[model samples]
Target: MPPSHTPVQYTTRIHDYPLHYTEAGSGEILLLIHGSLCDYRYWRWQIPALSQHYRVVAPSLRGFWPAALRSADDSFSIAQHIRDMSAFARRLGEGRPVHVLGHSRGAQIALELACGAPQEVRSLILADPGFRIAGEAPGAPLHTTVAKLLERGEVEPALAEFVDAVNGAGTWRQMVSWFKTMVTDNAYTLLSQIREINLDVDLDRARRLQCPVLLVGGAHSPARYGSRLDRLEQAVGQARRITIPAASHGMNLANPKAFNQGVLNFLAGLRADEARPPAGIP
Candidate 1:
């Protein structure tokens, strides 16, 4: 069994919202971000492994499980989450550049923060995140959609459908396994926006990355995904991509060994690259 993860909790205010985060180990800062419907618990594997050589900071994203809800405007917009994360980095990064890892929706948020504050971020690992169209009907708000789903018991099914590759039957079954009851309870309560409330990032702006980057995904991910990471590699100009063969959409949970090793290997190479002297220097 993997050693238990004992995280030290820290509560701080970012803008007007209260931020709840966990910290452990001591070295260069390594920030971890979780996707929608998940709290920091999602990074349990990487947190302990990475912490051995880096200071780990995992925050419960606002509008997600362990964080406070600030707006009825589907509080989990990419912009607000990015802003909040940037604020957290500004306040907690403590003058040292930090490395960041984000999964799913969290990956989108991390991308925005790194773009907006390049100096604060030394490297980034973005896992399996892409665009999502969440709204329909101009006048019908996203929260209204959530309410309708609540009435029709469609929420879990909808969420489960998201991981069809993992769930053999389809959405409802997948949702039951992915969201679970407790996670669903929290998810249904936080109203969402008709569309992503913040930044709109897809393959378009991937070329703008200013730091070392690692694009991560599952080797067995659904074939429908068109290798966005491959596109990112071309655009980023200095980024690398790695897929975990033993994993699926959710690599961290499904194949922790491969995920941890992939991350550690990449981080080690990054540190080595930085430590190496200018090529051609005597």
Candidate 2:
């Protein structure tokens, strides 16, 4: 079993909202971004391990969990998330470019930040990034089903259907009680995402990023997700790929060992690259 983390909690005011976050360890900064309908705790399996080598900071995106919600007009967009993450990284890193790892929708936000504010991010690890690709309307059926179920006031069943769609059938039964509570707490946000159009990312910009990027995917994830990652890998000039076996869209929770080791290895390579001298000088 993977070691669990008891994160130190903190909140910082950003753009008229208080952003709640969890932190552990101490060293250079590493930001972990979670997907929709979840908070920083989604990265619980990762914090204790990664924090040993780097200060891991995972913040709940605005309008989720402890973070107070604002009007949709004032919050909830990829651009907004990018701004929040950039500001969070800057304040936490004290002007140093911090390392970032994002999963699912959070991955889309991370890519946007790396492209829009490259100077704020040192390197990136994107696991099953949730972005529309090749004009594919991924998750539409599930989203519609969940939205209808939520409309009919069947919150639990709605959540179950949604969870099963992402994590595989029967996963909801295996999920911890608190995990279910977490999802239920964010039920509204999950419903809103069905119609949200703010997370669309620009691959043209992503391809231009000069920093090292590791694109991760789960071996058993839906084909659409794998296909999108493949397209993204091909788009990014400095990208590498890794697939965690026996895993699905929710790879971090499904296979933390492979996910954690993959990240550690990527960070190690980045360090090695920095240690290498100028090519002509050697």
Question: Which tens-of-lDDT digit does each residue in 109-186 have in candidate 1?
Answer: 888778888888889998886433222112214345554555576766444543453323443453434347435645
Model 1 regions more than 4 Å off: 1-7, 67-74, 132-147, 151-155, 163-182, 197-199, 202-204, 224-226
Best by TM-score: 2
What TM-score, to 2 decimals, does candidate 2 have?
A: 0.92
Segments in model 2 whose C-alpha atoms lie over 4 Å from true places? 1-6, 68-74, 137-139, 197-199
Worst 10 residues of 2 by lDDT: 66-75
Best by lDDT: 2
Residue 208's lDDT in candidate 1: 78
Model 1 CA lDDT for position 151: 51
Q: TM-scores, in order shown?
A: 0.82, 0.92
* lDDT (Cα) of model 2: 0.82
> How many clashes in each candidate?
4, 0
